[model samples]
Target chain A: MQQDAARLKVTHEGDIVQVEFTSRKILDEANIAEIGDQLSALVEAEHRPRLVISFAGVDHLSSAALGTLITINNKVKNRDGQLRLCNINPQIFEVFLITKLNTLFHIYPTIKEALESLRSGAQTGRLQ
Target chain B: MRPVFARVVTGTLMKHLKLQAGSRGRRESREKSVGLWCSEEFPSQMAEGRRVEEKILSQCRKYAYGQRDLFALKLALEEAICNAIRHGNKSTPNKHVRVKYRITRERIDVMVEDEGSGFDPAVLPDPTADQNLERACGRGVLLMRAYMNNVVFNSVGNSVMLTKFNESYSSSDTPINSTTVAFG
Candidate 1:
């Protein structure tokens, strides 16, 4: 029904929902909305209550995409869920740091680290 | 197929290239300014801004713009386009968004115009403010102003022009100032 996980890859790892962007760069306006909707649906699918957006494949993303992240973060917040972002490239990381979004998100350096945090309920801000 | 010849000239010399077609000759004069133009009707298609940005970035590289400036311009231009599309046009497919970027050795000037009614930049709440930090889309204008050397808006507020001067390296390839960007 959902493009067979075309835009992003969704997987479950021990009660953690990991959403991986399929594109190397999610800079398009139309794609941003699609991503937001997909993440929202994931939030609604079952009661994982823990989400992690992996940027391992992404290099660049526009501010609109950042806005989408904010929307998704807010949605997760409202649902009493936790969202973690990991494997963000340096350039994209600069955007988060510039906008001070680094403070709002629990960012990890790797997907494994993020998963471990989710399992252990550890909160981290920015990857140093 | 006939071969096309391109020449590179320095200084203020007027360079002309002659293209031969049959018995006629066409003389093309090279201009010093490099520019990119794009127009989209709202609700605009996805990645239109990114496409325009790619073109502008290519032009910047062709003009030997420094990487720092190129990155700053990319961010500033993208933000301006987003503002025009999302705020000025309100994502209405009927309205049109226009973007133009003119880059010279001295500076890069970008203009973004939208069909929607103008807005008051003065009235915009600071996106970095504590109360407004979580807002979805209020930081575009601020980023543009922060990254570009000069940002000016028309009286109607539907159009904005951003300018960024070349840092250190001018048309003569000499360092003027090391400052890459300025905040206002």
Candidate 2:
């Protein structure tokens, strides 16, 4: 499993791959690269395209992490897979709003919500 | 009559010492401004930028800065430092990037300097524009300005200074309620 190679907790709900973060602080440079690489590798796995990265354990992340997310999103799209994120801290949530990345990614309020939405294949505008 | 003269001399010296003590007090306040600095050599193999960001965030938290303000400071500091290493120094191990910050009760100020020749901040394309929306590289400068209260570039553009004001902080020898901060 790609999650075995990095600091992510990989779970599965039907076809959805839930990658929960295990770190309280994801702002470290090496950790950012590790998470990005792990997620990127997951995206390349055959027959496993849908992803939901849970940020419940993460208090905050660096801007380089943001760039990593963007790169991973691009890679997922190229593979015809979808990626979603959820459980972001309020401070990090504000960062997403500031960078307009909220528009670029499907951000749910919780892991359950993200899984449910992705499972239902519903495209909703959660950003306002 | 001699005793009176001695008393007068003693009073004069005490007054002069008080004056000197007052000036010293003023200088002490100036010195009380807290500062942190880090330097990274070019061609650095590690992501030192992330570690620096974490350090700034920890300092802000220790000072009881509001969560929103801390987030802004974190974003601005990270962008500035990374820009120094990646763009200004061009990741050349031969050059270097230096970061410094001063935090007071009223505000926090930071500076990031790089060894490379600077570019004009005005000439950079607007990252928020439609054509630039898909691009990943240009948002660092934009985020720094958006999150910081003040962003100033030095002549030649090799360095930047960022400042943010705080309404909830009080810098005193005895802080009344420093533990009551909301960290979000």
Candidate 3:
């Protein structure tokens, strides 16, 4: 099967992979699935892959997108990697609060903060 | 590839009309105050679903729904339509999902129904539970309920109704609170 077009813009800042969504809305199931696959591949390609996903330009996200994030977080954890999410707007952040996912993932207000936390090995604990 | 037509009143509105007349006999009822109503059915495909969603959002823009309201409706509508397509219809190409909505100055009410044997929403596992937090699914209904003012599931569960009051509309008589209710 042909691969779907990449929905993420990924950059490498040292060992940490910085990812941003190319679309304003990450609610489409196919797109979310493709993004999950792409992120999973990135995690599988390296040892202890450190990832930072930024929701800077994103305006809306569905529960499916959140599910994909959880899956990616689990994959990173299984590989002994770290993942940090940042740049989430208030509306999207409300989703995390409502779902109680705010406690599960490491969230930061900006990419610089996320990078700093990753480098300092802070907020690495996962909810059991 | 069903043709979508906006600006038409729906049967649901007529039912509301009767209820309002019998209850309060008032001219300011929601059914009589609607600015636009859209009812359409689309094939069980994500692309088709998205097209309908955009059309509805465009109609909402005409009413000047704020960015926050638009964001919440978009998120909730996506979840409802996705559930109708994937879980309710099992993504069968021949099946269809019916979407009906009414937009008023105060709120937007939407209904999405699919052609499949429905499951009980009560049986859904809580995605927020510690053991289930890492699971990759079952959060759609939760998000819909959280963002919308009210979410209702029909007895069979093949259909869902979502409503969100405009931020500026501060009427204390909200028909339903921000929670999931089961209706026949």
Interface RMSD of 1: 1.7
Candidate 2 residue-wise lDDT at B45: 27
lDDT of 3 by residue, B36-142 (tens): 45678888999989998898889788777888888888888899999999999999988999987877767788889999999898999998899988898899898
Expressed as tens digits, the lDDT of each residue in A17-101 for candidate 2 is 8898888877666788788888887788835499888889687776778888888888887887788888887878877877778
Q: How far is A85's C-alpha from truth in model 1 (Å)?
A: 0.8
User: Per-residue lDDT of A14-88 in model 3, one digit per residue for the tens?
Assistant: 898988888888988888888898988889998999999999999888888998999899999999989999999
| Highest-TM-score candidate | 3
How does candidate 1 score on lDDT? Answer: 0.70
- Range of the 10 consecutive residues with the lowest summed lDDT in candidate 2 chain A: A119-128
The docking category that best describes candidate 2 is: acceptable
- Among these predictions, the greatest lDDT belongs to 3
lDDT of 1 by residue, B1-184 (tens): 1122222332232111111111122221113332222233223333665667777678778777886788778878778888887787787766666665556666676677887788989999877676776788777877787778878888899888888876635443332221222111
Query: For candidate 1, lDDT tens digit of each residue in A43-123?
Result: 887554799889987866767887888888888888888999999978778877777778878999989989888888887
Per-candidate count of clashing residue pairs (backbone under 3 Å): 4, 4, 0
Q: Give the poorly placed runs of model 3, Cα more than 4 Å off.
A: A1-5, A124-128, B1-16, B28-37, B170-184
Q: Name the weakest run of 10 consecutive residues (lDDT summed) in model 1 chain B.
A: B14-23
Q: Which of candidates 1 and 3 reaches a greater DockQ?
A: 3
The positional error of residue B50 in candidate 3, measured at the CA in angstroms, is: 1.1
